[model samples]
Target: MKWVTYEAGAGERTGILDGETVRGLAPGTTLAGLLAAGALVEAGDDARRAPTEVLGTDDVRLLAPLPRPVSIRDGLCFLDHLRGCHRALGRDESLHPAWSENPGFYFANADAIVGPYDDVPVAPGSTMFDLELEVAAVVGTGGRDLDPRRAEEHIVGYTFYNDWTARDHQLRDMAQGIGMGKSKDSAITLGPALVTVDELEPFRRDGRLAFEVSASVGDRELTRGSLATMDWTFGELLAYVSRGADLTPGAVVGSGTVPGGCLLEHVDTPDLAAFTGWLQPGDVVSLRGEGLGETRQTVRPARPVIPLRDGA
Candidate 1:
């Protein structure tokens, strides 16, 4: 069942997406509640019961599918991405052979997430905006120090993620041995809908999830890669992250960026001005997976600001 958080006349509520229509759930609805409610309603069912019984399309504004996630973790699991990016930047020496052997990840602020339809604002006083197309999973059960072999059981479903980056800020922070710069603002865009594990099981073969990922800016195709290229499995990432830490339900974990994923991996003489050269106001970024639905976002300049008066 595809789930979503959306806004109607009644305000933000959880719902299921059926075709082009949306069926609203109760206010403050949650994945846990749906599970507890047992009979998860279909979007079509909700649509049939809408005020006019015709599905209120205008009332539906898609929010991030999962509203109140407990935690969000992302993994750098793609090896081909690392190699291709490093090679593109002429920095193969910085590439670590063991990156694929061990899982690398980062924590994302769950509360700060935005939906696929939301307008992404570029950072002010900055010109180096970048995008990373990724596939991320949501955890269904809470566990600690989980064994890698059984880590799949903890997953609830999958969603598309665009790990937006400010390249200039990211580089400065990386130079300082921390990742604060790359992770500011509404840097993470998640949703459209959550495709459950059962729906994605067929895509997994020999213990690895396989899916094609592609990204585009307007009519320009930016990157294309597969989830099969990852060096470490999602299980490994879950196990590693769960060590001595609680993995709670609704926690999202990303599958990192794929090859040619971002300009950082594809460009040399990395600079903000040069990286965002192709991006202009009103450029649409579309990311799609095999089964998961597509998420399209338009790029817009950051909101203008006025300078503060001295000693105000």
Candidate 2:
């Protein structure tokens, strides 16, 4: 089932997207609440048996499936993306041996998430605005030190994630040998809907979801890749994440950028100002997957950046 959270009248509501209509669940129902209660599947079944209300597509405005997830962890599962990005940065193009030893990830801004159709503002002082096409799994059960073989049972569903980035800021911050910093905290988009694991059975190949994803900037198609190309599985990634930490419900685990999923991997240099294809205000960026839904966002001007230190 495709679950969604949308705006209705003066309040928010949760529903199941069935074809062109929406089968409304109880008022104030949220994906986060359902997952935290360990009743996502039960709630879905109940809604199917008796929908409280039904509305057409034009009746409601969709929001992120879980507007404020508990936490967000983005994993680097695809080696091609890393290799391509390394070459673009004038670094070694060969795969790093450390990358093969672990399914590593970085913590992201959970408060920065937006809906599928929301307008994303370019980061202030950023000239190289870019987007990373990814797939993320939402946790349904809380666990610690989870076994990789049984981690799949903790996942509730999958959703599309557009990990928007300020390329210039990211490069500068990472150059200091620290984290990626807040370069990606400006805006991260998720949803259209949260598709349950069972719903994706048709796309499963060799026990992995093998869906193809593509992204476009307005009329021009930028890149396309497959999720099955990931070197590590979601289970292994989640297992590593829960090594000594708690993997709680409503937490999101991203599968990182797919191979060739972002413009950073395709560009030769970090000089976006000299590049004509950089995203501009009013540009529409759309991403679509074979099974997961599409995420379409419009770029907007950035807000003024505040100085962090004493006046220079």
**lDDT for 13 (candidate 2):** 86
Report the CA-based lDDT of candidate 1 relative to the real structure.
0.74
Listing every candidate in turn, what is its Cα RMSD in Å to the true structure after a full C-alpha superposition? 3.6, 1.5
- Tens-digit lDDT string for candidate 1 (1-312): 577777766667766666677666656665556644443444325534662222455667777877656677878887777776556545654665566467888787766687888888776545667788998888877789999999979887888988887666665777898656544545588888887787788889888888788988888888888788777888898999999999877788999898787766667553424543544568888898788888889888976645578654
**Cα shift from native, residue 173, model 1 (Å):** 0.5
Query: Which residue pairs does candidate 1 place in steric collision?
Result: none
Model 1: weakest 10-residue lDDT segment is 35-44
Candidate 2 local lDDT, 21-62, one digit each (tens): 888888878888988888887888888889988889788888
TM-scores, in order shown?
Answer: 0.86, 0.96
The parts of candidate 2 lying over 4 Å away from their true place are: 269-273, 309-312
